[model samples]
Target: MIESILPSYVVSEDLFEDPPDTMLFPEEEKAVEVAVDKRRREFTTARLCARRAMARLGLPPVPVVPGPRGEPGWPSGIVGSMTHCTGYRAAVLGRSARVATIGIDAEPNEVLTQGVLEVISLPAERERLRELARRSEGVCWERLLFSAKESVYKAWFPLTGLWLDFEEADLSIGPDDGTFSARLLVPGPVVDGSEVTAFSGRWLVRDGLILTAIVLPAPATTAGSPPGASPGSELIGS
Candidate 1:
């Protein structure tokens, strides 16, 4: 479902259940060695999803460890992101040469816990979400907007290697096109001598899940080739 919005170079895969220990790579097992059973399971399952995505790209599965800030440290020639939630786990991978960056997020299709919408959303964003809720039936626009910001931050951090607060970005959602745009209130990331102050992405509400994804092409006029290495925000399993 997430693939529909991405470019052809990106490969995404999703899993609906927790696989057994047999799905883990040796190095991956070591990375989650200290975690309790639950964390370990979630981490391993996400990695497995990543490996399957890599396979679709014709690349072998490599241990996707945690970087300095707990972001996924993808394999040498891959740019990717991972996310997981109850009953769902997913990963999106793209060849570093063809895709600049990728960000995908999954959230349960439910309202945010009390106070979280205010904590993570701007006053304007909250007001817009309220209006969206009145128009869309059976959708939690608050959580959907939260997921959009999460996707924006996930993409922003890797490009800038800087932190993006939840309230720092403003979002506008389109009901008809399944697309949203984010304007960076702070100075944006510089890529290939150009500054990116805004981001655009696609979203969907499906099967009790809210999914949002962003994909940036190679900085130059070509298909394959990205800039220097960077890290992104750490996700809480999902």
Candidate 2:
């Protein structure tokens, strides 16, 4: 489901069930050493998926340890993101030379947990959600909004190495297009010499899951010109 929404240059792996054979790297195991069984299972499985993605990129399996903010640390020259929720776990990777950053998230297709929408959403976003809900009762737009912001932060953190609060991004979701765009309310990151003022991503609701993804291509280069002369490639699934 995730691959359908990403570009060919990206490698994506998602697991519906924690593979019984999933094992963590020695270094990775220490991150969750004292966690409950559930935490260990998801942490281990997400890394397992990440390693599988690395192998697809023609790289060897390595420990996918978390950074200070819990962002998965990727191998040099690789940019990626991972997410796990309920029965879903996923990892997406791209070469740093071809892709600037990637962010993804998965959530059960249901209403937001009580009080979550208020904390994460801007007032404008909440009004839009109501309109979307009225238009299509099938999708949990509130939950989708939360997932989109999570993707925004996942992508934002890697570039800026700073925190992006939930209320920092104002989202505009398309009720029919399976897409959304995030307008960064604060100063955006500068990627490959260009300032990223906003982000556009794709979303999907299928079976019992809602998935969202954002991929920013690395800037194109030329012999005489500086980077960011043109986007490395068109944004995926735009």
Candidate 3:
């Protein structure tokens, strides 16, 4: 189901439930060793999803540990993200040569808790969400907005190594195209000699879940054979 929303170059794996055999490496287990049963289950299963994605990329299974900010630390030359919510867990990966960064998120298709939307959304974004709700029925636009911002932060952090607040990025959602655009309200990151002040991504709400993804591609014109090791030159399918 996750593959349906991503581009062809990305390798993705998702699971609706934790498998009985799910196991975590010693290093990976340390991150969740003290957590409750539910936290342990989700952390372990999400790594399982990530390793499966790694195998699909023709790479051997490796322990996926957390970085300083709790982001998954991918192997060298790999860019990826992991998300888990309720009954769903998913991971997506792409080669650094073809892709610069990747962000994917999943959330239950339910309206935001009262006052929660106001905390995560800008006034402009809230106004836009109201407009979107009028156009589309049966979809949780507020939750979708939160999910899109989560995805944007996932994609933003790895490149900038900095934090991005929900209020720092303004979003404009499309009611018809399953797409959204994010405009950075602060100084933007520069990739391959150009500043990226904006980003575009795709979203979907289906089967009681809301999924959002963002993939940025490496510069294709770099002098190196495969490509330069710099950040993305352009958004892929964004």
TM-score of each: 0.89, 0.93, 0.93
Judged by whole-model lDDT over C-alpha atoms, candidate 3 comes out at: 0.83
RMSDs, each prediction? 5.2, 4.0, 3.9
Task: Extract clashing residue pairs from model 3.
Answer: none
Query: Clashes in each model (backbone N, CA, C under 3 Å)?
Result: 3, 0, 0
lDDT of 1 by residue, 46-68 (tens): 88889889899888777888876
- Residue 164 miss distance in model 2 (angstroms): 0.5
lDDT of each: 0.77, 0.84, 0.83
Best prediction by lDDT: 2
Query: Per lDDT, what order, best first?
Result: 2, 3, 1
C-alpha lDDT of residue 51 in model 3: 92
Model 3: residue 191 alpha-carbon error in angstroms = 1.6
lDDT (tens digit, per residue) of candidate 3 on 1-238 = 7777677778999999999888889998888889999888889888999999999999999999998999999999999999999999999999998777788899999988999999999998889888888887988999999999999999888889999999998988878877887888988877767777876678888889999988777666233422212234435311
Displacement of the residue 140 alpha carbon in candidate 3, Å: 0.5
TM match of model 3 to true structure: 0.93
Candidate 1 TM-score, true structure as reference? 0.89
